[model samples]
Target: MSQFALLGKRRFAPFFWTQALGAFNDNAFRNALVMLVAFQMGLDDHTVSLYTNLAPALFIIPFFLFSATAGQLAEKYEKSRIIRYVKLFEIGAMVLAAYGFYTHHTSLLLIVLFMMGMHSATFGPIKYAILPQALQQGELVGGNGLIETGTQLAMLIGMIVGSALMEIAGLGPLLAGAITIAVALVGYLSSRGIPEAPATAPDLKFNWNPISETARVLKLTGQDRPVFNAVLGISWFWFFGTVLIAQLPNYTRINLGGDGSVNILVLTLFSIGTGIGSLLCERMSGRRVEVGLVPLGAFGLTAFGVDLFFARPDAALIHGLNWLAFLHSAGGWRIVLDLTLIGVFAGFYVVPLFAFIQSRAPREQLSRVIAGNNILNALLICCAAGFGLGLGMLGLGVPEIFLATAVLNALVALYIFTLVPEFVMRFITWVLVNTLYRVRIEGTQHIPEDGPVLLVCNHVSFMDPLLLMANLRRPVRFVMYYKIFNTPLLSFVFRTAKAIPIAGHKEDPQVLHQAYDAIDAALAGGEAVCIFPEGGLTADGEIAPFRPGVEKILARRPVPVVPMALRGVWGSVWSRRDSGLGRARLPRRFRARVELVVDAAFGSEQVTAASLEARVRELRGDRA
Candidate 1:
């Protein structure tokens, strides 16, 4: 089903609108305040600068102070109720904002900004934590994509509408105020339709002190190294985004020679591009939480970012051109394409990380982990602000700042990928699989979401492990012959994936025994392991006779055994179709159609080498 189908379901639709509306109101109010302070109030340059600079800090402060507490609240109470209360708080804040707008009370409006920030901080944990409770495992990525798409568009629209409303003469503040309050009310109404989500940690003790709780929350977030790295990756995204967004207004004015309309045009293009990318993730990932896209996203961010700098290296000779005029100028469309792709890549980069965190973190601690993510995001955002300011102080123009950020993004991505080689490994696997074949997967639901399972499959091609890795939602450790495992160019991926390499007993008894031990240990620790009972790849696109190795492993560890088969890969590039010749042959067809069929798992006691091989052959049928 399309991810959009979630909009028709009671489980998702209400919350989606609620959150989207909340985002709309948040941006609307903030941009409206900016308009009031910067343009309408007639403040001096320094005072305007002071208010502009202070706004973001005022908004972010609550996250640092209340995120831990909010996390606990999300964990200890019913989520729907909390959301209702949050909306109510938003309503109250907007009411006060309406008063401030009418009276031209700058202090009161600033206080309202702080209140809005508090609203966001309180909502952050529940925002992510409730998704897992409400969405199925398969829907996680698509759901996240929709949420991201909604947020991006809503925020963009809110900014435009709010600023436009505030730009109106004599009635700007009143209109902005009314719209914000109405949106807040609508958000509350939509939230009322959200289904109940019971707390994951209802029995846990609550800690009220922010300092101690914040420390504890951070520590809890780091418990799972990969998840914590995902959090850091997310935070880095905020940092990168902050730098880009902070520079855009000036970049539009100075580099593109565009007026305010052009700035909005750039933002609209970016937001639309992000929404497109977000929606494409489900199709790209085949409804799985695929981290492989992260590396791809990182590469695009750097590539397009550098291209953006090179696309226009100097300020325009003309100033104050409208958006349409700017588009007609030299290199205009190129700039548009660069900004849009950056946003597209940003979507690709972030959606999977969020899904990974949701799928991998302990349910009880997920809320706290999200809260930790928020806190770090806020900190990185601040740092990004400073980084931009520092560059400006260094007399670097916006284009130069873009260039530096792109370089730094490359470095940061390299560092993260090095720390977690699995991301890179998966990227390689995903790329190879997607490039070589159009895979149709069946019966994946039979694969357990968690726990140890032994996967037995036909040994048809060298690309089998990677194909399976790309398709399966959960990670699988494959057992392969040492020679294949050590193959040049592919060894890095194998090692990073922790594939167990073995040799025949006659050739290397030590390696064989060690492989068995590793397999057993992995299964015992609740990991899935795949092994080809045929012992080696088939030489002639036929199933080789089953070997006894699988039986031996299962005797030692009586885990479930899932039989799997791959079709149409027998003549592919990595297969042994050219074993009789000197070199591998090119595929007769590019992107050859392939099928992966997984049967319901057999209980350990019910599986034998002969039976499992027969089942795999039956699954493969005459497809090869």
Candidate 2:
């Protein structure tokens, strides 16, 4: 089903709109404040700079002070109720905003900004934590995509509408404030329709001290390295985003030589492009949490970012041009494409990381993990801002900053990919599997979520292990002949996955004994291990006779044996066909349909070499 299908269900739709509306209001209010302080009020340069700097600071400081507490609250209370209360807080904040706007009270308005930030901090944990409760495991990537798409688009629209509304002749601030309140009210109403999301840690005691709790929350995030790294990756994305967003107004004015409309046009293109990429993730990723796409995103960010540098030079001049004039100017279309692709890649980069974190983090601590991510994200954003300031102080222009960021993006991505080759390995596997053939996995749920199991399957092709490793939800440690395990291209994958390499007793009694020992140890430790009972791939695309190795392994460890079969790989290019590689050549099939059928596990006492082969043959039937 399309991820959009979630919108039709009460489990998701209400919460989606509520979150979108809140993002919209936040951006709207901030941008309107910016417009009023910068362009409309005729403040001096220093004063304008002061408010511009203070606005973001005021908005983000609360996250540092409150996210730890908010994480605990989300864990201890019904999330939907917390959401309702946060919306109430937003309403109260908007009320204060209304009074400040009407009375032109700058202090009061800044206070409202701080309140709105507090409101966002309060919702941060609940917003992410509630998703796992509302969404199924398979739906997580799709759901996260939709949420991200909504947020970017909402931010774009809200900024435009809020600033435009506030610029009206008389009662401008009043109208903007009213709209903000109205949006907040509707958001609260939408949140009411959300189904209940019970707390994952209801009995947890709340800690009142922000200092110690914040430290504890951060420490909690580090408990899972992959998850914490995902958080860091996400924070890196925000760092890039913060820099680009902070630079946009100045970039549009000085570099692009465009007016306000062109600025909006740029923002719109980037936002919409990101939405498109976010929405496409499900299909491109084959409906899985594909971290492979993250590297693809990183590549795009650098490639297009560098292209943007060349597309609009520092020397270009088109002063005060409107959107139309800017588009008609030299290199205008290229600039637009660069910005759009940058956003698209940003979407690809961020959505998967979010889904991965959500799916992997422990349910009980998901909120606290998200809160830790927020705190780190806030810190990284500040660092990004500092970076831009340092560059500016060094006599760098905005475009130069883009170039520098792009170069840094490449270096950082390489560092990250090197640190975690699994991401790159998965990306490669996903691409090859997706491109080489259509693969369907049946009875995947038969694979236990945990514990040891001996997986017995018919060896059909050279790619059997790759197929099973790539597609199966659970990790499977395969026992294979050492020679096959050491195949040139597949060796890295095998070693990285830690596949157990064994040999025939006559050929290498030592290796065979070691393999048996390793298998026993793995099972004893509650790890899943798979073995091909056929001992080797089928030369003619038929199941090879079952070997005694399966019986021996079972006798030693006595674990559940899952019988599996691969169908429709007989004549494929990768499979051994005709007599020899240099003779009897024939046309190779492209993207042949392949099915992996898994049957219910045979209880330890029920499985034998003969029974597993017979069951697999039955499952394969005539397809073999």
Q: Could you say which candidate leads in lDDT?
A: 1
TM-scores for every candidate against the unseen true structure: 0.98, 0.95
- Give the distance in Å from residue 214's predicted Cα in candidate 2 to where it truly belongs: 1.4
Tens-place lDDT per residue, model 2, 203-302, is 9989999999999999999998878888888999989888888788889999899999999999998898889889888877766677878888999999
Q: Candidate 2: global Cα-lDDT?
A: 0.87
List residue ranges in candidate 1 displaced over 4 A.
581-584
Candidate 1 structure, TM-score to reference: 0.98
Against the unseen true structure, what C-alpha lDDT does each candidate score?
0.93, 0.87
Question: What is candidate 1's lDDT per residue for 510-583, written digit by digit as tens?
Answer: 99989999999999999999999998889888999899888899899999999999999877777877665656
**Among all candidates shown, the one with the greatest TM-score:** 1
Clashes of each: 0, 0
